[model samples]
Target: MTDSQSNLIDRYQQYRTRRFLANESQTSSWLPGWRTQKRRRILVGALLAIFVAMLAVGVTCHFGVEWAPLLWLPVCLVFMPVWVALRVASGRQDDAPEAVLDEFEIDQRNGARSIGFAVMQSLGLIAAFYLIFGAVITNGDNGDMVYAGGIFTLMAVLIGGCTPAMILAWTRPDPDVDDLS
Candidate 1:
């Protein structure tokens, strides 16, 4: 290559390296501020709280069709994975490289996030369908169980999965080059 071309290549490479390193250094030590934490916490709580309230209603009223509170239970299932993710992925941030999750943990979290996204997308579609055609029902005995059980389950799983996945995506540090592409 010509000297100017070679110089240009070198500069680009250096720039890339410097930029990558800068990202690593900055993100590695990044700790969420109180305000950010408060916001995320509120978001998560609000998202999950609706499901919990529904659950309380279902239990309190014995999942009655008249109350139709039982329908809320299935919708609340997404809370499970989100809660797990929060527990597993919490406390991950520091200057030390070892402070971050290893490849396996990172991969697992990414996989979970992907699943969460898919579940959430599916929930959106389901909601749209329900809005257009009314809640899913069939010859399944008075339509209450189908509405409360099937639709509720979908809602729960979506909320539960999406909440934690969002929290992780927002709060977790950028992965090291070796751990994630």
Candidate 2:
């Protein structure tokens, strides 16, 4: 990369690091009572269920169910922000740069990321197979299938991106009462 490109990338990383750190520091006030493992697990489950619903809506819309998009819009707008909050509440352990994390944290983050990557690869392969076989099955009249494929790909991306944070949130212990105070 050119100097300017490298500098831009570095700046963006710094910004992201700062943002995550800020979130960590302010999480209690911003997302009160969400520090519990049980609540976080619920949030993760809800997010996954929403993603599945989104995929269903996308398929339904492809089949001429026109009102599905109306349901999708509000859900997307609301839940996506919740996903961000979940990442923040989870301490951004999966995303914080290595320098910001301790050895144990780094190992945990890496393991979660590894699992997320594997999930992504598997889902991506499924999406690819769907597109290819779908086109063949339709004798190349695959316009609707393309839309479905796109939605499936997007669902894959969302699930894969969130997996690490979800894993961390679900597995992490509740904050110590002393620590909360």
* lDDT tens digits, residue span 1-181, model 2: 8999999999988888788777667774666577688888888988988887888877886675656657677768867787977876676777888767889888989999999999988988898898889888898685667777887887788788889999989988987878666
> Which is the leading candidate under TM-score?
2
The segments of candidate 1 whose C-alpha lies over 4 angstroms from its true place after superposition are: 1-35, 56-62, 65-139, 169-181
Off by more than 4 A, model 2: 1-19, 26-28
What global local distance difference test value does model 1 have?
A: 0.50
lDDT per model vs. reference: 0.50, 0.81
Candidate closest to the true structure, highest lDDT: 2
Candidate 1, 48-148: lDDT as tens digits: 67566655543443334475554454544655544433332333221113224577666656665666667677766765554444333434344544444
List of clashing residue pairs for candidate 2: none
TM-score of each: 0.35, 0.82
- lDDT assessment of candidate 2: 0.81
